[model samples]
Target: TDIPHFSTTDWTWAKGALQTVDRPYGPLLNLLHHGIGSTHVCHHINPRIPHYNAWYASALLKNNFPDLVRYDSTPIHKALWRIATRCTVVSQRGGIDGYFYQPKPSI
Candidate 1:
């Protein structure tokens, strides 16, 4: 994942692509949460956009980078539990320069 020629913006986009998950929880719930829960990837891509405009930006990002944007529909509680239980460890691949979350080992 380490590309030596990538600029800081490119690196940020790459990180956001890997880590940001915009979880849609209905319009009413999204409104209640001020769009943070649903338009999180937009937030990561550009933190300056006001919450009111994040939806539009998120849609734009989704449209332009369909392969890169991660729209996770998993319930918040379940995702939290999964992360808590299985995402604790980070390890670097042998001879690699970066660290990544280790996949959970099968029993």
Candidate 2:
């Protein structure tokens, strides 16, 4: 429904990957890291030590969580991943519409 939100960390990671030269998923990685990495597009920064690392943690949670990971095979995940990574899953963005939208990152 929205442009898709992401944390600053997500934005940075995607940005870093995009900026890297000779990286396999250059275009797609950049898209995910910067394209959708936003407060509106992703979880808000943690009140304490809020930064890119926070979003990186978010990625880890989404990947390890069983229920969340299950969505990887679902159509929504399929479509989003395809669009973001261009069919290449070099990195993972965790959660769905509301999962980490207001993320309060753990220490």
Candidate 3:
């Protein structure tokens, strides 16, 4: 994996959380989803944090690590269309580390 090495354990944990989780929806839906869908970043970073406390943890992560915390605001419907139309989700990165949906080249 071409995963970049971190200089400190804190950064390693934060970056790892960012890469592993995604906040797919806004706060309103987050409550409906029990934060698992919206505050997923914090959950992965510290699974010990309860769902109710996760929202706060997620806010802290976003405020402290704005660059690292990425919340995809794309409408779910549109995102689905994009996935169905052209992009076959390419999850395997051949030893690379990071989360992204890449399109496979059309055959």
lDDT of 3 by residue, 1-107 (tens): 12233334335665766564453666677667786877777888889999989878889988998876666666555656766886656454555454346667778
Clashing residue pair totals per candidate (backbone < 3 A): 0, 9, 1
User: In candidate 2, what are the lDDT values of residues 18-96, reduced to their tens digit?
Assistant: 2211112234654565423321112332324244554465466456642322112223344455556542222234563
**Top of the candidates by lDDT:** 1
Clashes of 1: 0
Residue 30, model 2: Cα distance from true site in angstroms: 3.1
List of clashing residue pairs for candidate 2: 4-41, 5-40, 5-41, 5-42, 6-38, 6-41, 6-42, 9-52, 14-33
State which candidate has the highest TM-score: 1
Worst 10 residues of 1 by lDDT: 1-10
Q: Rate the local accuracy (lDDT) of all candidates.
A: 0.71, 0.35, 0.65
lDDT of 1 at 53: 97
Off by over 4 Å in 3: 1-16, 24-29, 89-101, 104-107
Candidate 2: residue 81 lDDT (0-100): 56
Sort the predicted structures by lDDT, highest score first. Answer: 1, 3, 2
Tens-digit lDDT track for model 1 on 1-107?
Answer: 12122235445555644566777677787778888888887887788999999989989988998877777778777777777787655765665445566547778
Better of 1 and 3 by lDDT: 1
